[model samples]
Target: MDHIFRASRQWERIQNRYITEDAAVDLTNLKSDPRNFKLSLWDPTTNGVRYLKTLAYHLGMELSPAELARIRRTPNREIGDPTTVRCGGETLCMDYLQATYEVGFIEREIDLSGARILEIGAGYGRTCHMIMSNHDISGYCIVDLKNTLRLSKAYLRQVLDEPRFKLIDFIEVDSLQDDSLRSERFDLCINIHSMTEMSPETVRAYLDLINETCSAFYVKNPVGKYIDKSLDGYLQGQEAVEMALENGPLRQLLDIHDSQAVQAAVPAFIEGYRPGDAWDCVGDSRALPWSYLWQALYKNPRKPSDG
Candidate 1:
């Protein structure tokens, strides 16, 4: 299988260099051979935009002038809760990524029950709701910028009314070092799509803080060898991550590292999900199903001091 995969890659290079125009059209005739289709999909040189458009058209998604306008105005903000948002034309809904990992977490039974969970980028508290709703757990806390914290508090209050769930709360702090934040500790820390919002220095600082104060941590982010320039929010380079990790404070706290596939949350498609003050645009925000969710866990090796 290794040799076959390698040879397949080599043939793709040849096709990209020598054959351009009729390659896709010709390949359709070769559909009987599954490897040919796989090779085409894997070809880096193939234009993904064209490919995706072709796929969408084949799936019978037609856009009228009004629908196209709706898509155009659809704000690209994070959907903390998909159930509340209206999907104008997208085929999939929320819970796609959440459900997959829920089963995985359950099978693993990794002891999330009643843990003092912390989610870094608790945008509108959707992921927070996932943890609190699904797992058998104790309490969860959210740390976010003042703007997001305000929006999340409002959203949660409107959407839910249950007593047992008081285990969840929101905190507003400037930097993690704000006297209020530094004085506290949590059992687990989570960072969803929030890492990209900060500078490398801030990421390292936050990681160090988590290491010193928290017992365990989880992060789901995009990292690896290949850099896809076309991604909507892909990192410019890997150095930001490297610099953060190499800095001493982050190095000591984390024990294990795991990389999981996260769907890149495309804000362009979501209605009402915007960069503006979401609180001000409550009824008017456009949102699309954002696919970015990664889960990485860290175990605190040294016992935290009982201060």
Candidate 2:
């Protein structure tokens, strides 16, 4: 039963920080915090922003001044108390801009019109909002840890109108069972960088769920391994544990898995796991360093063994 669906210590720290800052005017400006630079669209390096802008243009956003103005008009930039900067003649938050690019990533492969989608980690509902804005999807669901779930709820409530908001479901991660997931089948399931923060078992459980029902899925995560580090910035693994014993920070390794563990779940033998006609799946360059688009398939529903 997910064995409590344990999250790695690092993610626990991140969620706890969000919970702790639930009241504080949150830091959306990249320059506000050094730690924000990693693991979140809430912050992006200068080059990352540049790449995002370039991607957006390629996706056809900035082809004209009106298009740029339209992008600037999107609510993601300032909604939910995020700080934004001026870029390419538009005021933007890297988080919001990054979300736009992600929605575009999925749209090119699948038609989101009336799609019933599920997102594993909806960071403050950024991508959810972006998807709803760009498409006329029937519904959306977000399953995540408690802290992040709360954040998404608060943000989505304000951004999405009553009808659209009511169509959405927010489930806690632990509540999604193996045998019975949601009442209705989903069209697509998405998981961004959050899986890199999950324990391997947790990641597989989610994949198993998607395998059971979703028509398709999209994933963007770090390239290899789910090596967790402590909040104090000490890497956690067998090597880390050894360091702890040998006069290191005394932080022991946590139960985690290498990236290959996930690859095992989605075997290349399965057509659903295959890359698009011309898409380069090993896209460490676009998402982030050592990060890649692991898989985005018009899923075939069941694994080969299900036959």
Q: Each candidate's TM vs. the true structure?
A: 0.48, 0.58
Over 100-134, each residue of candidate 1 has an lDDT whose tens digit, in order, gives 34323322423666566667777776556555544
Looking at model 1, which ten-residue stretch has the lowest summed lDDT? 278-287
Per-model tally of clashing residue pairs: 18, 1
Residues 89-108 of candidate 2: C-alpha lDDT, one tens digit per residue: 56665566566556655756
RMSD in order of candidates = 15.8, 17.0
Model 1 misplacement above 4 A: 1-92, 99-103, 106-109, 175-178, 224-295, 304-307
lDDT of 2 at 65: 51
lDDT of all predictions: 0.47, 0.59
